[model samples]
Target: MHLRALPLDRAPVRLRQWVFLVDADERAAEAAFVALFAPGQDPGLGRALVADDGGGWLWERHQEFSTWTWFAFGPLGSELGFEAQPAETFFWLYGAPGEVFRGVEISVSAPEAQPPSEVALSRHIDLHRCVSCEVFDGAARIWTDFRLREGGTGRIHVANHSLAHDEVSRLVQTLLEIGNYRKLALIGFPPARELLAWLDGAEGRLASITSGLATGEDSQAVLDQLLALSAEVELRAAKNQFRRGATESYHRLTLDRLEALRERRVPGHSTMSEFIARRLLPAMRTREAADRRLDDLSVRIARSGDLLRTKLGLAQDRQNQETLRGMDASLQLQTKLQGLVEGLSIFAVGYYVLGLLGYLLKPWLHGWPGGAEIVLSGLVPLVLVVAAASLHRRKKRLIAGRD
Candidate 1:
């Protein structure tokens, strides 16, 4: 992952946007060269040869991940040269694309007998002092980096093989002293701890999310962790900033108090106003990026929590409404059943009364029927009414259950 983007005021010049890691045969005299010139496709700005000191160049280029596949071209007709050997030296590329022309990289692995001094020496050698040089006949490799920036800020780096053992601390401190984005320099050995610390401490704080070999985990995981760490770091940093500011203010106040006491020596010192802005506040309040970041993250988290709470409340409200509707439906079915029960009771009473009347009539007309005939007719109506009521009750229950 990449570091946080530099702030507008602190943006570094886009110079050495590309970085190269290389290994070559010790016998090779010609240093390997990696560069970008634009408009590269055209005869553009010719070529600006950037010296390789300890700090490399920074440039502006577009890229996806930090890794890339690159095709090295051979020069003209020379099959073994850089231009002709397109397939000979295939390697992974990193950083921005070809748009950045901030600087260039040249690597040469040479024997002790033929040191870097011998390689870079030319008729113009006296005119252009090489910022860095190295010679390794046996196992040692010389790596250098350069920095170039506005003002006269820049640096040169030269060292032997085995990057792990090199004096990186001195190199970094020196670069920081120069305080220029253009300070070209070199660093070698697989990416290491010193480099990580230097990068994190320099410029703006590494973005809230960043990854490198030093972080020890895969890039994605490292990025996630770094983001979390960034939040805490920013908050802490902001608090620290305020603390420092207050301390400075206190110091200034003490100074003012001392100055006021000294005024007793003057004849008419009492005529002057006791307050002094400069004494009370020695410096302007500088905004820390870390503080801004913390605020942004807090706002985002708060908004997210609010949105989730609203959604949950709405869901619960909807569920309660559904329950209320169900309860209403059940009450309506119960009311209908109650009315049917009352109607059935009335029907039963009326049938009984009709049966009694029929029984009495049977006595009035004795030749018409036996007592059994009167009983059968009255019982039929009672049985039919009861059956109808049962059917209605069953239908109501089924409908209620469906609901």
Candidate 2:
């Protein structure tokens, strides 16, 4: 029996895949997976796992989500009535503790259906309202409506002509991965859209605040607003930091997976790679635009802050200069008053010395007559000069002591 990853399909074989969209909690998903698949078994599937339980199992865990794939070996009847049949693991999958993002059903017609009649294949998928394309170098053809069918799951049909066992698995993997990554990449679109509106208002406010810079308007208020704007921008950046990064990573994965398909052109259809690149680029561009806008607004805010601070500093400097001028005038007035006080003190000190000298020399003057009077007159003038010199010497001594 052809079982698990090494199924040998010499005859026409049918391969069906049901890829369910999973929540972002990898841990919780892994736990539920362990309880279901490995219960009392390996429990540690690591990242990628391949096993057999009446079918092939492909389980992969990523940072933000996980995927579980089960393929049954058998024939799908009459389009499987277009009814997607869940495998034995269906209940476990649905019961898995994660929110469904999207689920897809892939049905591959076996090698006998190789190079399926284009017209027939197209009509086969037409009932499903799908988009059709041929790939695998004319060895295989694919059809998908990309619409949620019976179980909110999109459908894809692959008719294999000459693909090897490994090639089949790899092809399925690449296609499924392309779908997964593409979905994850666009996850940032909604947040980016919402952020753009907020950014527009922030930029407008910043522009208004910046215009104030030209005309020194309400500097304090302007500074306050600038601070607020800075906080707002920073908050937005912090909030979307992971989302933006995830978008870029997922976008890259989407492209990589699409390229891995090695898609070949079918006469009248487009390759998945081309289709994805066309639509994915614009979403990525939107993310890019949002990022660029954030950075631009941040730069503008910083410049505004710098300009505001410079203006404030200049204003403070001007105020300080005015204050210094008033202080200088006050200092000059004090100097003049001090000079007058010093002059009066010198005169008063000289007068007191003369009075004491006259008293002491009165007896001698009476004896010397005119000679005594002349000597006393000259001595009085010399006494005043001595008083001034002594005061100057004392002032120098006091200053020297302080130093």
All candidates: TM-score: 0.27, 0.81
lDDT (tens digit, per residue) of candidate 1 on 136-255 = 221232222233422222222222232222222222222222222111111111122232343345323333222232343354454455455546545554545544444344444444
For model 1, the local distance difference test gives 0.34
Best by TM-score: 2
Q: Rate the local accuracy (lDDT) of all candidates.
A: 0.34, 0.71
Give candidate 2 misplaced runs (Cα > 4 Å). Answer: 1-33, 41-50, 80-83, 86-88, 115-124, 127-131, 134-139, 348-380, 393-403
- Model 1's C-alpha root-mean-square deviation from the true structure amounts to 21.5
Q: Which whole-number lDDT from 0 to 100 does residue 112 have in model 1?
A: 26
Residue lDDT tens for model 2, 319-377 = 99999999999999999998798777888998898778777778777877676567668
Report the lDDT of model 1 for residue 14.
15
Candidate 2 at residue 60, lDDT? 53
- Cα-based lDDT at residue 306, candidate 2: 85
